[model samples]
Target chain A: MEKSKTNPNKDFYGKTLMGIEIFVRSLIEENVDVVFGCPGNAVLGIFDALLEISGIKIILARHEFGAVLSASGYARATGKPGVVVASSGPGASNLVTGIADANMDSVPLVIFTAQVPTKLIGNETFQEVDIVGITRPITKHNFLVTKIEELTSTIKSAFHIATTGRPGPVLVDLPRDILAEKFTFDYPEKVNLRGYNPIYSAHSGQIKRAAEIINNSLRPVIIAGGGVTISNAFGELRELARKINSPVATTLMGQGVYPEDDQLSLGMIGMHGTWYANNAVNESDCVIAIGSRLDERVTGDFNKFAPKAKKIHIDIDPSSISKNIKADVPIVGDVKDALKKLIPLVKNLNNEEWLSQIKKWKNEHPLKYKSTDKVSVPFVIEKLRDLTGANAVIVTDVGQFQMWTAQFFKFLYPRTHITSGGLGTMGFSLPASIGVAITVKDRPVISINGNRGFQINLQELATVTAYNLPIKILIFNDGHIDITRQWQELQWRKKFDEILIDSSCPDFIKIADAYGIQSFRVEMANEVEPTLKKALALKDKPVLIEFKTIYEENIFPYIPLGGSVSDIIEH
Target chain B: MRHTISILVENKFGVLTRIAGLFSAKGYNIESISVGPTEDPSISRMTIVTNGDDDQIEQIIKHLNKLIDILKVVDLTNEPFVERELALIKVKVNPYTRGDVIEISDIFRAKVVDIGPTTLTVEVTGKSDKITAMINMLAPYGIVELARTGVVALKREFKGEVYTSKEIKLIKKKSRQKQVEDDEKG
Candidate 1:
């Protein structure tokens, strides 16, 4: 509706609205359903504007870090760009880790941060930080809106840049003065960035060449990554794998992109990957790496990673194609598009002997763990996965619990398993689980975290209780950073250093109780399942179940640093 | 393993920072970088010289192309391109070496832009190698100060599509109108 009385250009303008209102309206135009925010003095006007908006919901996080992590989780789970807002200075600085994580993982997010008034910006005013400068490297793109005229357009550009191409976090630093200023509310329908054009389809010639390579190779293994999930190429990945009679191995980030329970699945392939997965990748004649950057954790030693294989890397980001491992056939396009084109050109292969060899390797060195007298983290993860089944969304924090969850959980679907794979951010689980729970309200959302990791953002418990989110928080309390200690023990001649956490770690059950969340602690093996079940049964409120796991327990099937895939320590 | 890359980008705020940040974050050492406005006021071109192996340079080009403000990235190191650097050198010129300095500047086709009692400022614009050679020849006269504008490069012949300012503006406007119409229909 045009407000001709107040508007100079009736055809191009609408009713005059506050800059804050325009910002919120632009987000709504982008189809953002929820915004995770922690309000401060600079963002009060925006908060006031948000209260009047009926269609969008704002989830108030206790900390700015919690807000961004939750938004990242929501983005990964829903396949939509997550939105977050925070006040100036410390609030914006607090978002650095989450922003970096989102960028590293290629999760789409649009972050709005409050800035000090434009006049007070460079005078060293209170609550003023060069947020744009700080986040320049981490964010895909960012804006510092100094003028009211640039507010809506900047917000629109931020959203477009965040969700397109290689999706990553984008920030818009809104000055407090602009938030209070009045402006015409004209949301741009589309952003036309001349520089940002992403290739969605593969070249037919390259696809044909890739198919020929796959069809000719008797020992071919497919290595899928987060790109597969991001592009929704799981179906295509499966079709291609089935056609070529190839076993599929996934990177940690690509865990759920292919069903782990499938006969052709080779679990995960990396440092902590299963023996068979590593062996299959090492022994393969051809390696089809889709949507993966081949990070150091996955590659072990770049010189020897898939050495014998003729590698084919298909990714949306061309920079990721040969950054770590050189690809013979580099298809710079979306994984789904590349796979779709490739499947048609590939003929069904009879690699029964190669498959049998892989099966023998799997039988010889399956994922093994001893069930000790005390409760173990991996055992709990397996039992929890069994109880929750394949429908539950699993989120994890970094460290030992993260690796254990990745190893034990059998994800049958994409977007069902969420973790900070690239950034390896600790304290991501609890808040991220809150986000996943919000996105998929009907499914069970479980967060598996270590004690050291969970306490990084323990304040998020308040947000979970405030929203009455039914997120099941499972804390594996080993009393210290278990993975670091394990590494020190193995590599540094058992000289335990700063890896041990101080005894001053908070009483987690009491901490959860303080936040009005249902809390439980289990130490015995028999009590684990019942505790998990009890936590899962609660429908109206969030629950925290802490298991006192063995402190010295180490994750096995580890490939030593700088070692090849074949040099695995399977203890 | 030196590579020359020419980047065409929108003349937007923070575009330089984004490009520089990408290079540093990815661990590519920039040997030299020069940014200046193109013929169109709305567009800027950046010439970056960096040292990396073939794969690293390719990755750098690809990464540069990924930036939202970058329109085009041309790695001219492998192409037939002409590159030039401008340097202003002030040399301490005594009576004995003043004639020698003037002779050297004359031989190199450099101009003496400024003269002080004991120093002569020589301005030289040539290929990077020539400029370096000139500086070395003037070093015998005891150089006092030096400032150099990093390399600016261009291909001898146009090989890619070049967008005029009007065409770019028109394309931007048309795309926006189409998007607005689509939104209204939806």
Candidate 2:
């Protein structure tokens, strides 16, 4: 909620102030500590303003994609709105994927794309692209500031909207001239928008009804997601789970919000989830879904997903409710707020019988890897988790390594595990960890990437070296895009793409060396521990460790496409 | 089922595209939508007509509310409402058929707004059904041109306005600020 009611400008509403200075001043007022961007001609005025500003630090990302991804990591880590700016045309276009990633994951980002001059907007001027038009569907909301008068309010509203209910990226595209233009400016003390109102708390009546359903349910389960982390509802989630004696299964994004090692934790649920979690959810009589969207990945086959469960969904966005599975009791508010009200209304009933049944299932079908002679990726993940004591901030790229990390690594704290769960964007971790490392200076931040994905944004190695962010880059080298290969192996008669060729894989250690970063390669199972220890011990600079594992290990506990929990692959 | 959705939105340039983009992205076809300014100059009212099942219609309203520029959404689909469409039909006419064309329009309570060399342009405002009947009656005369203001509607009860109580307070504060400024000047 906007608490500032008095317009600090007082008598200066119409007083002429340079647009460029107001831009920087507004960010300072918002308490923005850092900005990530690559400058171009269209952003000249922004660079000028930053030249005069003292406190705000501007870091140049090697690529525009890296800038936005780094900002996404920062937003997830610090729970503050991330800021990133880019120049017109190609620069603006490059930030689309990263912005879309943030949008999909509900990460709050305020992006500014400098545009060509207003007069040349439609005339196809040099280096001109309709970025606002391009980013329209991806962004939560966006503004094209044609007038200098609307600049301050647009910026204020962008920040407000980005940080509020169901937070996501909001872009503000400024024409170059508007930035340079002299405008009568006064920053609004409070944002007044007719169209935007976010519900912070839910109805007590709904909470009582949900509690009633829980009390009567003999088999109950809780599915948590990033919203749990975003709302900081970990304690409330734990309390609700213990009070009801329900097993907690999280979406891939919700990995660390509920400690994975907790007895109630069902690890991660979905296509690559534990068999026990999937079965528990499928057989549940009442499912309390807190802050998770229950996307297709989480609910494998909608027809059979929690088939018997009377769902009570708590989320800040009303649209997120019943977008997939219908909510029996939809509490439309902040998950944290709803959970707080709900904890008091519930009975302290531990369904010991139900929990014991889940424990038997977990024992029968535990998440484990084969006793392979080649280096095991899952073992490496587990060793690293054990070495870090499950407190390291783990960021990952898409595919097999990501699934393995979610399965083996037990995250103990909220925001400890970040990945491109929804968008599944490749090469997300390398740049995103830069954001996490920059925000969290005290914690050990690790970027775990597959060999194929690490090469996608390899240019960010220069950025990692320049910033000296102590991010341990763990590349699971299996010499193939194993996820697609797994599909080929299962669906086809082993006819594959050129994914298995050794010539296609690059030596990441040499690449890290070229970037002047400390590099290591571990090829033996025994070598994983000593190398990880060495890498995590080096606190001053970034290190890249490439782990060479068997090329053909497929992620199991699989749910076939359009397949239900009952049809889960056990082996 | 066809749903008549009335949305109160901020009168901004991108509001139209945002609404249009939202519907298109969700794979729903918008049959007809008309937007015009409300009594409050800063607010615009958009009436969108679309076809979907109950679940789809509910999802549509939720998506509309999700847009930041959309202030209020009322699915007046099931309510008692008054609906109207205004149409200007220009029909090809001979000197001999001009009188007959005037009589046909007159029967529908329409007006002959203009008479060209070989065309009788008639202006009609009524419910969409009535407008459809009038156009069909004139179809034999070789309709030359047609322009329509697609379905604009209002509930019979007139429940509320676009601004909320919070907006009124802000407006009062603004007026008070203006009063202080005027007093200082005087």
Listed per prediction, chain B TM-scores read 0.83, 0.82
Model 1 alpha-carbon miss at residue A338, Å? 0.8
- Report the lDDT tens digits of candidate 2 across residue range A1-571: 1335452334445678788877887786677889999988888678768767536888788899999999999998989999998999998999999999999999999999998889989888888889899999999999899999888889999999999999999999989888888977667878878678889989999999999999899999999999999999889899889888889999998988888878999999999999998999989999999888989989988878898999999999898899899999999999889999999989998798998999999889999887675698899998998898987899989988899999999778888888998899998999999999988987899999988889888899999888888999999887878787887777775775664554667778789989999999889988889999999999878999988889868888899877888777765
DockQ of each: 0.62, 0.59
For lDDT, the strongest prediction is 2
Give the C-alpha miss distance for residue A318 in model 1, angstroms: 0.5
Alpha-carbon DockQ of candidate 2: 0.59
TM-score of each model, in listed order = 0.93, 0.93
